[model samples]
Target: MVLRVNGLFGWVRANDRRSIALFGGLILAINVGAALFLLLPLLAVDPDHAPVTAWGGYARRYVPLVTLAAGAVFALHLMRHVRSVQRLTGFAFVDDADEPRLCRLVEPLAIGMGLPAPYVGVIEARALNAFACGLGRRDAVVVVTRGLIDALDDEELAAVLAHELAHIVNGDIRLLAAADAGLRLVGWLARPPAARRQQVGALLSLPVIMAVLPPLFVFILIAGICGQAAIRGSRLIRLMISSSREFIADACAVEATQNPAALVSALRRIDGRSRLNHLPPGQDAMMIDGASEGGFATHPTIARRIAVIVAVTGSMALNAPKRRDTRSPDQRDRAACAIRTGVFGAAPPASERGTPDLVDPGDARNWLGFTPVMTLGAVLAVAVFLGMHRHDLHRPAALAAALDPRPAGILLAVVGREFVCNAAFSSVGLALRATGLDRPVGCDAAPARDLAAAQTSGSVGRFLAALTEPPAGLSMHPNGTFGSAPSPATEAETVRTRRCFRTKGYARGDGGLHAVDAPPRRDGAFDIGRWLAGAEAQAVQTAAAGPEAGDRPLDDYLSSRKSIVHAVDRYFGEPGLAMMRRSFASPSHQRAIGRLRERLGDPRWAAGLPPVRRAEFTLLANSPEDFVTCSARDRMDRKATVPPT
Candidate 1:
């Protein structure tokens, strides 16, 4: 008979440490393999050549470049993941009002572990569960279900936060993310799909194969079969191996917080509640399941996790001293202050407030039916185009080769690019959605007005119509006029309330360009404030920037705009800021800027900047020879222009 509790508190700590060490060693091995795979090709090209003079030299020259590109892509993927997590977590009914109190409890524990305060979020589900997600500490998000919040008191909550912090500290997320991306690339590269029929003519050419001969045929066929099998096997193995990381994380959490009972209690509650709130499957490891052990389990069983935690801490609880607020004297004053400020007053009526649509048009459920058809249409369209314009098929192989830039790499690269790019575009569609409901019945785009009059159509029909038809008067040009500017009365009221930043309007024309008006602004010197302030200002604009900004009440506009702008700014700020910054940079800065200039294509801005020159320079001391080779310090004086790619 096994002593379950004893096993829980015993052996887990040691096992977890060992697992972590193993993981680090495995990662090192992976890096070594990557290095070798990259180097072997160059070696095979010309072994007789000097190692430095040969492919090794080229590899060395481009390793940094490759690393930078890969790193940037990974960073972008992680950022996207965080945003997705935030949105899904925010949507759940968890009350954020208690976040400060929750933070207060978790902060001490975080400090005890030398970690930054973990972001705490609440979901409005009755599941006693929590998960920590982010690529790293600075970007992490902690989401706790409503049930978890309701079930666990302060101490337990701290314990849960500590456990998640352990995951962060161990860099579990980073490791898992790397593993996932690597496997995906490997899978993509291994099972390269064939191009369409027209594009496959070259592969079918008898003479082309005759030139390459039986060796090429034998190699390609064998590699294709074996490579696909290996990739599939690797994926399954990766999934299996990854589950152990969860157990290791549980142990790490115990070490970080030095509390076992709290975690155990939280687990008991979560298990009992049995309320399921699944995040995207890709993010399952970040959830509370420590050892998703079964069908879709990404972690081990709770019992095993508890055992691990118990083994490490040995029944000791590392409880920190709680803050005691003994401010009896200030109670009456606080009550009086609240009354004076009207903070305790009755809630405002619904009509007085702004309301966002109950549904979002681009939500996965709303788009689910249409997306498949749209995607199939896109694929079929590409196939049809390739078939009809068979002459154009000549480029696919060359294009594939260029994209992959390696022999036989084209097939894999093209397939991956198509899938990834399409997914990215789908995400973009989701990001741009404004409303969920369909246009009202009889609400067709009136040709002259470009506006659809609201009627009583079902939400789905209106949504479809909105996508299929352009509004009547809306010009798809980005620079199209936004009618007249707001009147003085509207401007004064908006400015007084400081809601100008988001009140601008935009209409898309047939060309798919959005013609937007000048967005409202604060009295600040710069365009937009920091993210939070910008969000507030934008919401104010969205509420007020409707049919008659010139006539709408500033109060009503402020209320309405607040909700819309908050989401818009949260999602769109970085790109928006880059756009705005490009619009107003000094001439010298503009000259130095490479990609920014090309993207903005503002002729005036480009013309204003001084021309950059490329020069070869040599350094010499006083009375020294003019042709002396420059040392690193001498080269510092020279400014080399980076050519825009």
Candidate 2:
């Protein structure tokens, strides 16, 4: 019962067939009405005075152009959308030989879903989430983060794979794109036309704000933001529909994998840990819904997703086996307990203090193969980057390439190479770095991936807090969210303080220290973004002078020399390491390095890690907050990723 392309396409087309029949009937009705109106006038007046055929000529001439325009747009959507989105958001194919484990797990799930195995891509992020993209089942690609592979147990991973496959089978990829475009059109209709830019200089200046983007790019940016806000009374309803699709996808995952508990566990593990939300506009609609919201949210809370899963499976325990199993309770429990070490290579719970997951040097998913396959992929990506840069030069050529399926697929494969982070690959940068490819003149101030600025912060305060206290061009929300909400005249307004941060002890091997961000014991109220950003930004630069001098965090106060090096480290790792050793690179971090030195002293430090790496570790430690307790505001949030021990 494998899902053949023919069968899948037929079913999808059958289920999603548009109202072309109805449109044809409506067209006949409209013509009939027009003829009756014209003929009735002729009946009242002289036949020669009537203008019955006046409108027919104009309709005949113009209708073809309208149809042609609609066809052209549909062709563009089918041809360009898949690859453009893959490139726009960083995503690369997962090499089966290199990442055998992920490939191994996904194939069975694909079979379970009755579809041809899907192409898998890695997002090269430390965030524990995944999203699917395709024009159809044949072209489908499921993109998982490096974090998702690292954290989830085998069954949980399978559940996720099944969910992504479900999206493909249901034609959700094209449907989502179509729905989003329709919504945008609705928004456009709801608002007046955009005002034209006043001057050429004003138009040219936009790219500077968006990391040296072109004028056309700025237009796309403005449209994405403005369109979402313009929709009227039905806006909330659309969001509800979006949210419902997620539930359906979840159900599909469960039905495919028969492991609702694993999906629940997987959802819990994600918990909005990565700072992907901050990465530019136009991508939010496509990525996983990890942002905070109220009524108009696209995805429900993790709790709600889990509750649905539990209700369907009728299994209350996270570790329980399938509900239909006739096995005795003890045997089922025993099977659950064995989850610590399975195909996914998980370890027992921390309370049990089991041995760590074995790390194989040859494991393709890890950094061991970086010198060969990983480096090769990086080289190919750079070439594709160059090609895409070249491709952007001629509009018609680019459009032609997009319209041609083979060329577009090749472009996506090459573009997708930039996806993995520097960890597993030769490169070390994470997913949030914008390509900034094909930017116009006056390009400068490129965002560095090593800094984690774009990838980590969730709340606006959290994102801003990562920058200098007065973060450049960022807005702060009095409420925990961005937009405002109205209150009744007699209602008592809620008073609140800004949520900030304090520090926890250094977490060794993580290359950073921990912050005790939570308030009431796992109340799930702690904001990861504020904890990381605000707490770090709060740190006084002990090495600086004057009142404002020593206040910047280690990240903001980097010497001009290291700033370029940090920027370079966005793609290259070892050079940043070399730059760190030049001199007091990170004074704030030195304190931690000093702590490590004292703790590991000379003999053990030498034995544990090479002398050369000591400096790199100190420099990799980003940001430093002066431990302070300010007036509490509702804190920002992001990831809850606990690194593998």
Candidate 3:
């Protein structure tokens, strides 16, 4: 337990350090930029301001002083009323006398985390959720809903409390509150009605804010409304900070409790329940759960988090079956049903329902490492690209001077196509050649125009065909009107002369990239407005899980993970998955993958593979030099077919 706790703590610290380092660097850069912004405006205020030519000296003297002064003031007021927001939203302070057990639970945990006890608050929410916030451990507040208190068992409750306490000890609670407030204010001011009026007010008040408060507050305000990108960027950064924070906090909780099972149990129970809470944007992050599987998400998926916990603990950690809930059984059942529908939505036809776990998916992951495309397609792409667009590349002034005569857009589009295609092909070729493996890479879908093109042409072929051909009009292609395939392959069955790899999700029986006419499940009865609405909310209805259904609702939901493509993207994003794939590509990777695939039986391959996956990642990490580039003579000299470039 001690060793597990220490390891989990170390993981927590590492993720915290990485995420915080990035957040800190961004904050420092923004502050420095803010100081420079204030300089010119401040100079204008000076009665005897330095002339434009001699302003360097003035800036050097004034910038640092103003920056420091403003930052100090902003730090104080930024998170001042954070707790009040929750209180005003109807959370009541918990009296120790009234809730001795809850207070008692927090005290020991706070002591373990080396922090003063946090204030506890309770919301009347029926949803099971809780979060922590404060300037630091000393004044931290852990807020829970009445439902959460009622729902979680003692161990689960302790786990939840420990998690929130972990947030306080981490010193992220306060920073999160400040950032959320800053970002929310920006979003509010960016809307049209607040446009010039808000801008004028902020600018006019800058002098007073700089003089009395911290210039940091002014900086944050300015950065918030800098532009749409700035506002969005801030929100994204904040969300990332929040996302990584949850993982660290979970680890910290495990360490504090020395029980990963409790946390996992709590997470699973709370996962779908929290959706019904009327949480504010900022508060949603602090909660046990919300929309955890999207781009602008606050937390990683509940299953992923649980898997991570299992990885950290090296234990099954699946709680002994819970003494199921009794009161409001119908309500619980309905919540579960809604969650199943919302998270998984409807399954596509059996043909489209299952995507295999391949070494690579859809040639989308590493565009440059694919072997089949690179060796055969890259040289051709370069020739075609230059031949078709060399005139435009040579014409420097054409963009500004040419009055729509040169077909510049067409030329640029083709160049982009060539560049993208070759990059994909090159990546494939590099991976194969590096691994000393000569394999074919082509889609196995029936020969539709695009599928045919995909099979024979470079990665660009499929992409271009999807855009221009029938059914799957992925996007508008310039090739439809302007030019033809420079080296078109006949629309015939692309034979698998070489070894073709399967991506995990898209691996069909034939093992090809284009298994369908269109990209996954976006086929059949597509309605513009309803589709958009459903995109935001997967409100598909599901019949009650019964004997005939022969499926666990939760399992179905987990299997059909929300935002399928986004989920796939995450697997690609992980270093562990990449390492595992790279290892599978070369003999070492390939052999390791073979053993691994045999061990991991079919069905439910995507989920809960984290433990073994992490072990493989560990193996790779330990012997990194062995896998770095598959040294031609290091050990496999006898079998080195193609040297790694």
Q: Pick the candidate with the highest TM-score.
A: 3
State, as a TM-score between 0 and 1, how close model 2 is to the true structure.
Answer: 0.36
**Candidate 2 residue 383 C-alpha distance from true site, Å:** 57
CA deviation > 4 Å runs, candidate 3: 1-7, 32-62, 87-89, 181-226, 276-278, 293-296, 319-645
Most accurate candidate by lDDT: 3
lDDT of 1 at 173: 64
Span of 10 residues, lowest total lDDT, candidate 3: 490-499
RMSD of each: 30.4, 35.0, 36.1
lDDT string for model 2 (417-519, tens) is 2222112233422322344222222122222221233222112213334432323443322111122222211111111111122123222224432233224
Model 1 is weakest, by summed lDDT over 10 consecutive residues, at 613-622
Lowest lDDT block of 10, candidate 2: 488-497
lDDT of 3 by residue, 1-645 (tens): 123335555666666677677566445444443443443344333312322323565557655665575466457545554544454335667878967767878888889889877788876655677888667766778887766766666777889999988888878787676666555443333322212244345334333322222222323334334534444556577777787788788888888887778888889878767753333333466666666654346777898888777776665475443433333555446545545555321222334222321111011111222234222333443444445445666675532232221122222334444444445657697786777543323311122332233332322333435544534323222223223321112111111111111122332122222212233346533222232233223212112234554323323322232233222223222332243333224443234333334333434653443332333333333442332221211223444666667
At residue 425, give the lDDT of candidate 3: 57
Backbone clash total, candidate 3: 27
Candidate 1 residue lDDT tens string, 326-345: 22344435434543553321
